[model samples]
Target: MELLVIVGVFFLLCAVFFIRTVSKKKAVDKAVDVDKDDSYAFEAIGALFTAAERSFYGVLTQSLKDNYVLLGKVRVADIIKPQGNLNRSEWQTAFNQISRKHIDFVICDKDNLSILCAIELNDSSHNKADRAQRDAFLSRALSSANIPFVEFTAKRSYVIRDIQNELHQFLAQQSSQTPSADTKICPCCSSQLVERVSKRGKNQGNTFWGCSAYPKCRYVEES
Candidate 1:
């Protein structure tokens, strides 16, 4: 009986030890997981724009002036979003393409601040294979979004008149299509037709009538 009692106590102690060990191991694993969850801290950097970019900003600003709002370093993801029935993986893949790329310049509406066009300053770096591929991807994405895109080679000297003319023509093309009174109402959202510029694609720089409540109303009519 004593021997049986001793075995029982031994088994009980073993069970208690095993339970404590597993609990301690679980606690350690959780602590390690918490440590793994820690993220890298960031530090402040210097100038956001490179010397080439800074020089171009002056030229772009002077060119745009009060006619349009020129914004620098706008992200592609912000300007273009995935459409259609996208699975999580597909959406993630699309997002990954543009997440890191930024447009050198974005021209927006002076009043409502809607994006009108994007510009890329093609420096020598753009000649590289990786940059070329990136440029092509960005171009396709922008085109798909029906946003107009322009590219200019880096130049030591930029003509203000040339910039002005380019912008003027591009903007003019956007609102060139006028909607008739009968078809002015948007079929999608029942909003009134508003004058808008095509910012990208084959019809880029073409002026077309769009939905007044756009971004919500995507209806478009050719003038």
Candidate 2:
């Protein structure tokens, strides 16, 4: 009877030890997971803009003065959402394309911060196949949005007046296109028509009328 009792106690102790071993393993794993959950360790980037971008920013500050708001590295998705007509899956697909893309610089209305234009500081890389394709996509997207897009080739030195002239030219165009009582309603979306300027290729700097709802309606009338 004593021998049987000893064997039973021995088995009981073995099970207890196995349970303790598993508990220790789980505790250690939990500790490791807690250590991994740390959210810190982020470091500051020395400056917001690269040397080239900084140089241009200076000129923009000078050119825009206090008349407009300038925001850098603005996300395209923030400026325009997928049109309401899109089905959920279609919206998700469209949103995914631009959720991470950014415009190099964005000029916005001072009062409301409405995007007046998006600018790209183009270097020679823009001429390459990949960059060109990406630029084309952005161009198409922004055009569909009816927001003005401007491009300036990167240069070792920039002329402030030149920048002012081009930007003001666009602003002037916008001023001219400002809606009046005579402006017609968009037949597609029922939004009023807005004036727009072409920003690319041979037709660049040309003016046209586009639906105010823009990317959503994409209705156009020749100016």
Candidate 3:
């Protein structure tokens, strides 16, 4: 009888201990659930431009306000399109290339926002051969579209008068030369073909009909 009594007491104690442990586990799980709910968050960041880029962007904006609208960090794909006889895979590749590249600034018409010129600020990094090659590629792309392209060395201050004079000269030159209507259109993108002047290698200074959507559409024809 004593043994039976002790066994009953032990079972009761075991049951109580099991219940307490389950209750504690449930409480812990509830606390963890609350923590998870509060965990997701984000914070504010500073300006996207560097000190030099910001200063030049301000100058460029102010200088262009009168005649042209200035757009910063414009994507190459936005201003240009791919046009040519391209298969589906080739078309995708062209679009991917243009999507990866960007122009620093684009000057557009105040009335219609048509791109007038593209500008690249050449910092010390641009002195590297790779950067120079990239710059040359961008220059050719703009030229092929009959859009004026200009490069400026980054500085703390800029002469607005010099910028205005250079733009005037480029606009005047563009007005003299026009893209031929008979040039073939790119199958990938409908943009027209414009004559581009070669700036490097053995074909330096030679003109060719290149798709307006340069890096995006690389179709070229001899002029």
Q: Residue by residue across 60-171, what tens digits does model 3's lDDT show?
A: 7766545467888899989876667788898788778678788888877554466767888889999999999988888877666556789999986899888778676433
**In candidate 2, how many Å is residue 202 off?**
18
Cα lDDT computed for each candidate against the true fold: 0.78, 0.80, 0.73
Candidate 3 or 2, higher lDDT: 2
Ordered from best to worst lDDT, the candidate numbers read: 2, 1, 3
In order of listing, the candidates' clash counts read 11, 1, 4
Candidates in order, TM-scores: namely: 0.67, 0.65, 0.57
Give the candidate order by descending TM-score.
Answer: 1, 2, 3
Give the alpha carbon lDDT tens digit for every residue of 48-154 in model 2.
88899999988898888565779998898998778899999999999999999999999875544556789999988889999899888888888776677889999
- In model 3, which regions exceed 4 Å deviation? 1-45, 171-223
Give residue 114's error in model 1 in angstroms. Answer: 0.6
Model 1 agreement with the true structure over 1-223: per-residue lDDT tens digits: 9999999999999999999999999999988997788575768777778888889889988876574778898988888898768999999998897898899999876656667778999999999999999898888888777676888889998998988787664564232234555646777866557566666668777878876544545777897
Off by over 4 Å in 1: 1-43, 173-208, 211-216
Lowest summed lDDT across 10 adjacent residues in model 2 is found at 169-178
Candidate 1's clash total is 11
